[model samples]
Structure formats: C-alpha cells, structure tokens
Target chain A: IAGITQAPTSQILAAGRRMTLRCTQDMRHNAMYWYRQDLGLGLRLIHYSNTAGTTGKGEVPDGYSVSRANTDDFPLTLASAVPSQTSVYFCASSRGTGELFFGEGSRLTVL
Target chain B: GESVGLHLPTLSVQEGDNSIINCAYSNSASDYFIWYKQESGKGPQFIIDIRSNMDKRQGQRVTVLLNKTVKHLSLQIAATQPGDSAVYFCAERATDSWGKFQFGAGTQVVVTP
Candidate 1:
C-alpha cells in the first residue's frame, strides 16, 4: 500500500526563496503532521492537522506553514527559506489517536 | 519540561545474539512510549509501544520494557539479523497531548555475522 508520499524527495533552494513540500496519503487518516529532523537532534514537530480544514502550530512552527486542504493532501510551505531550515522533512498520518505512518522524507538544503 | 534521549548512539551485535537498546525520558506524565525503526533513507516505522500502566509489551521478536521508576525504557531484539541494522528512535507522549510526541535523536544498530 502507498502509505504516504512526499514530493520532491530532495531539493535545493536559495535563501529567502519560497518553497513548498507536498504530502499525500492514501490511508485517509484524520490527522497529519509535519516534522523536521536535524543532526544531533530528534524529529521536531513543525505543524499538524487533526482533520481537513484545520491546522495547528507545533513545537517548531516558525518559518513554516502547513495546510490540510483535503483528506489526502497536506502541503508545507516556507514563506522564505533560510539556512537553518535545511533538514529532512517528514510527513505522517494517523487515524484518530492511533499510531502514525510516515513518509520517506524530503531532504531540503537552503543556500 | 520533557525530554527523551537514547543512551548510546550506535550498537553492534552479532547475528543470532540478542540486542538491547536503552532510552531515558524526563517526563513523569508521559502516558505512552514508542520505538520506531528507520532504515537508511526511509521514514521511521513503528516497532512497538508501551503504555505507562504496563511495564512491558512484546511483539514478534521484539520486546519493549518500560521502567517508570527510573524513567527508563528498553527494546530487546531476539536473534539479531542484518535487517535489524537501522536507527531506532524513542518517543514519548505526555497525558493530554494527542500526537505531540517527544522524540530522541535515535540509536543506530548494526548486526554483524
């Protein structure tokens, strides 16, 4: 089964440029989340949506925004990319408070 | 204030031997603890989870032990295999936090023949 798919597996962007990372899940889960993984640090929550049309900020939501337009898609956008935003981004989905299923991840590098 | 951390960054075990990974959490209110395995270049997958009310949970060849007394958690894998070579992350969720999991950097496991 195609659990979760993240677009642009890897990307490079110039600082201050706008960018968006796409995420789609076939599980039809009610909740979705975005997290960033950095070296020496654990995965930090960036944003999460409990259901469609609802979004909430996470621990490190600064410089990042996420939207759950429908049950299947939740895209993360960066208004202005910065060097500190360079990291592996992961998308995950879950049903209610159940376990989370994660995507392969999108490696982003800002120069 | 809550934090989850792994004791060792890397662990090497011989094939067929049992391997144990340790984790520590500072949140006494954590209701659930989870272990996730991430293969190279892949997203983290659930291995097992233990609730605070329970001290241990078992799955396939994996066993998760939670010691709330010491705020410690451990994952034991029976008969280590090459497929078990991956990074293992420990996560904790406090009571009232739905999906807000506090994660650790992860421990890398290497199984050798």
Candidate 2:
C-alpha cells in the first residue's frame, strides 16, 4: 500500500552542507513526526506536526527543522549538517491517539 | 527529566523457550504504551500495546504487561523462534500530547536455534 515512502535511503554528505529528507504518507494521517536514531540511543523526536500548517519542536530539534504544509508530506531539513548529525532519520504518521506508521528510514552520514 | 529505559541491553533465548523483555518509564502520567520490533535496516514495527488501566494484554504469541504502580512494562513472547530475533523497543505516549511518544533505548533479542 506504500503507507509511507522516504527518499534517498542512504546518503553521504560533507559537513556544512544542506540536506533535506523527504517523507510522504498515503494513509492521510493527521499527525506526522521526525525522529533520529543513533547507536545506544533510541528514537528522539526532532519535530512534529499535529496537523497541516502546524509544527512543534520536539526533544532534539536543534540541528533540524520541519514543515507540514499539507497532510501527505512533511519534510525535515538540516540547514548545515555536522558530523554528529550522522544518524538514521525516520518519518512517522498516525491518526490521533493511534499507533504510528513509520517509513523505511533515511540513513545520512555526515563527514 | 522523565525517560523510558530498558532493563537489559541484550537478551539471548533458546528456541521454544519463553522470553521476557523489560522496560521502565519514569513518567507516571503516561497513560498509553507500545512495544515495537525493529529488524536490520528497517523501521520499527508495531508489536503490541497496553494502556495504563490494563495490567496485561495478549496477542497471538505475545503478551504485554504494564505495572503502573511500579512504572514498569514487559513483553513476553512464547515459543521463541529465530525469526523473533530483533531489537525491541518500548515507548510511552506523552500524556500532554496524545500523539507524541517517548521510546526506550531498546533491547536486542537474539533467539538461538
């Protein structure tokens, strides 16, 4: 059903470069989220949107930003990537108070 | 700072034996919890979930136990198989934000045949 689709499954970028991770959900969920996964650390919320046109900061939103202009797409942007930003990024969507459906994930390596 | 954590970083279980993965949450206000299984090179998959009001919930071959009094959660798998090997994570839904969830570090379950 292609519940959620993420682009650039893997990428290697130089530090100080700009990158954007694309996420799209066909489920037509109301809420979308961006999370990063690092070794020894579970998923940490970077940013989230309860609905279209509303974005909120999450636990770790410093090096990241997100926009939810529509219900089907919520993209995460890294203005200037750093070495420490090298981690796997996941996009998730869910209806209110329901289980989340996550994307396959985008693995970005900042060198 | 409230957080969710796992009791063990890794667990090894033999095939056909039952396995239990433990989790602890510091947020007493959390009312809903979920268990997810993540395999290699993939996103976390929903396994089971339990609400704070319920002590235990069972699925086909899995059971989730929630201890709100102690703020602990557990996932039990019966007849463990090699296919069950993966990293399991426990997450708590934020009371303030019904759609927001905080996840634990995770426990790697390795089922030996």
User: Could you tell me the TM-score of candidate 1?
Assistant: 0.95
What is the lDDT for B52 in model 2?
A: 83
Q: Write the per-residue lDDT of candidate 2 for residues B1-113, one digit (tens) a residue.
A: 99885354889999999999999999999999999999999999999998888999999899999998899999999999999999999999867877989999999999988
CAPRI-style grade of the A/B interface in model 2: medium
Question: Candidate 1 overall Cα lDDT vs. reference?
Answer: 0.93
Q: What is the DockQ of candidate 1?
A: 0.59
How high is each candidate's TM-score? 0.95, 0.95
> Best candidate per DockQ, number?
2
| lDDT (Cα atoms) of all candidates against the true structure | 0.93, 0.94
Model 2: residues with Cα > 4 Å off, grouped in runs: B1-8
DockQ score of the complex predicted as candidate 2: 0.59
Model number with the top TM-score: 2
DockQ for the candidates, in order: 0.59, 0.59
After TM-score superposition, the amount by which residue B1's alpha carbon in candidate 1 deviates from its true location, in angstroms, is 37
